[model samples]
Target: MTESLNISIQFGGGAELLFDKIKKREVDLPALKKYLPDCQREKWTIRELLLWIKENLLREREELFLQGDSVRPGILVLINDADWELCGELDYELQNRDTIMFISTLHGG
Candidate 1:
């Protein structure tokens, strides 16, 4: 049997506005193998997590949150308090209990 992956998600610096002003969330993701038949890997990556968030959590303005399968520029992504860029960005495999944060750097003047 496949197990669910549990993780924490946070939005900040105006990014929360896209998620109904919610700053934090606890998400349980389904097994990758079962969730995506084409996926051969046993682990979840930030890329998949972003897709999941767009489908399940993002409230509106998807264009503002995502761009061509990744987060739009000006949004900073952190995994467990470290920059996602340091963690390999979309290729970084997600671990149970990992805390992922998205902070928007763009703001209208």
Candidate 2:
């Protein structure tokens, strides 16, 4: 059997399933898992994670992360060994057996 989405998280290289659940899951579960190791380790479903963050984390559009402030928190970001913005934006479509990477960066002296 083969999965429609096959992505890799460089540091440890974890396996994940990618699917956008508009209504079912309130949060971006797959994204949280892929990018945030802590979220994945907790084994949180997209629905759970999203609701949690919606109720816990996430701020206003003052600081947009993905896409042109339209996607809000667009999943399927591609960034390997680098930060989020550096990688391609949400425009990245679904690539068969695609290996997506999630990287968060911080800049300072």
Could you estimate the TM-score for every candidate?
A: 0.95, 0.26
Give me the candidate number with maximum TM-score. 1
Candidate 2 weakest lDDT stretch, 10 residues: 11-20
Tens digits of per-residue lDDT, candidate 2, 1-109, equal 1222333322111111122212112222244345454543333332332343334443443233233332234243344434345534433333333343422242224
Highest lDDT model number:
1
Q: Which lDDT values do the candidates have, in the order given? A: 0.93, 0.33
Q: How accurate locally is residue 82 in candidate 2, as Cα lDDT from 0 to 100?
A: 40
For model 1, residues 3-95, the per-residue Cα lDDT tens digits are 999999999999999999999999889999878879867899999899889888999999998999899999999999999989999999999
TM-score of 1: 0.95
